[model samples]
Target: MMAATDALAGVLTQMTGPWPVSAAARELAAAGVPVFPCVPGGKRPLTEHGFHDATTDPGQVEAWWRTHPDANLAVPTGATSGMVVVDVDVHAPTDGYEAFERAYRAGLVSRWAFLVSTPSGGMHAYYPATPDRAQRSWQAARPGVDFRGDGGYILLPPSMVSTNGATVGYRVRQINTGPSATLDSDRLRDFLDPRPTPPPTTSDDVQRSADVSRLATWVAARGEGERNRGLFWAACRLAENGVPAPDALDVLTAAASQSGLGEREITTTVRSAYRTTQPQARPSSTVQGSPRAADGWFARDATVRTSAPGRRLS
Candidate 1:
């Protein structure tokens, strides 16, 4: 029997993976990569949003390909594909390509899973968009190199480019498909998109966490009449830094209850605190009798989208 890699190679050969644009689009869409159309036989976007229009929905993919069967394919770079592409161009006369070589020789760019050879004699080195790397596109940060990242898109494989009846299509240059190949490479990330300063280390995190914990402890020790006022003050402090209301309620409610407040009292106090914090979201003074009213309050505030899991960013 053939080796697993050989088997996958054989399977790839049977399908039009990087061949006809429609087939390439279908395959990529199925693999969770959002695909959108560039102009048929050209490179401009067919949709208004360009790469933002990329969707993994099979039906949308089918519908798009159905309408523009010959359209060129493009996928959003960065987190959309869970990747960023380091584009090194041989066609350009700039020193960017040379800069890439220097960086590579310096033992940078040591991580990448696969690469695509572009029609213009350039290459797109694919690497995962590691969460901490802060991936974003750059043009000529070196010379002939570009980063196809947060706001960039890449021509999908098998999408043909032709000039004056001469055709040149992107083709796969390397394929391992192993876990190492598929995983994001932090080293390669540093080479392409180095942060000016190191990311914040654990010291700040540890201090903030300790501070919050101490505050929680103090709130939990408040006595009966002061329970609501204490909880409200604590919730406001948490909200000042954009902590999610639900989380603040969870922490402070536990604190309030230990101070002898009832469930209804705790809920009302927290809700009022949140409303006062977000005065724009405040409703009329009258109370509604809907059974789901409390739930509605929570849901309305659920619009707070978190940057980190426990905290929202303003």
Candidate 2:
């Protein structure tokens, strides 16, 4: 998901143009993404307020640059600019590119996208912001990656920051010249900020998973009055999830026996429950159902989509 640090800054090496911060600001404002100024040779905002002072006004932008000709260009993220950025420090194999790779294989980031080469040899992948609530800035999702979402901003192309007594600037590695539209970030959030995996739901771990264990215990504790009903319900739960009828029957029988259900009643209840839950009647075809029958059963596949297809990233 990241290029080498050498290649990171190389993203903008071919540039041959005037370092006109004001002109760049005008272009961004014309694109409808608001802009602001950060003190040149530094990232401190020139405006009294920080990102909140971002403006689309050409006059303000001209005046600000006129006052401080060397100020860097910063764009507020979130709704105003309609974008979020994934900040990747190009320290692969050191900081956490391996961790980032794991997330990437898990489908965390889009391979082809626009990015801005950062001043500190980092690359910022830009994604259109989703329409929902603003996402707050996140620090170090992995060792090398950070996120600038809602309530945050990024110093943009043609913006210079000082390093090693010299000036380095951000440049558009991938340029978006079309109408800005949202990029689906549900996958990014889920992958970067994943929930811990719960224990598996294998028969061995049936007791390990709280939901299955609770249901099993509920069946095993039923008394005479509730014995058949409990066994049927529990068996039904297993069968509907395509547990083999025999496996389901075996579990229900053991639990019902402990609950004082006679053998005949246990067999009849389990068989009837299985029949209703598994319409195929054959146990061989019982491998198709919900949570109880999944690989990483609690795993949810998040939807990923571009706001619009064919939007070029230059």
lDDT, model 2, position 284:
24
Clashing pairs in 1: 18-158, 96-143, 96-144
Point out where model 2 deviates above 4 Å: 1-16, 90-93, 96-102, 111-113, 175-190, 193-314
Cα RMSD (angstroms) for every candidate in the order listed = 21.3, 22.3
lDDT of 2 by residue, 72-161 (tens): 887776665666777665333333334344554565654424556565655676666666565655444224465666556677667777
TM-score of candidate 2 versus the correct structure, residues matched by position: 0.53
Please provide, for model 1 over 7-39, each residue's C-alpha lDDT reduced to its tens digit, 9 standing for 90 to 100. Answer: 323333444433677876776677666788887
Model 1: ten consecutive residues of lowest lDDT: 297-306
List per-prediction Cα lDDT, in the order shown.
0.57, 0.57
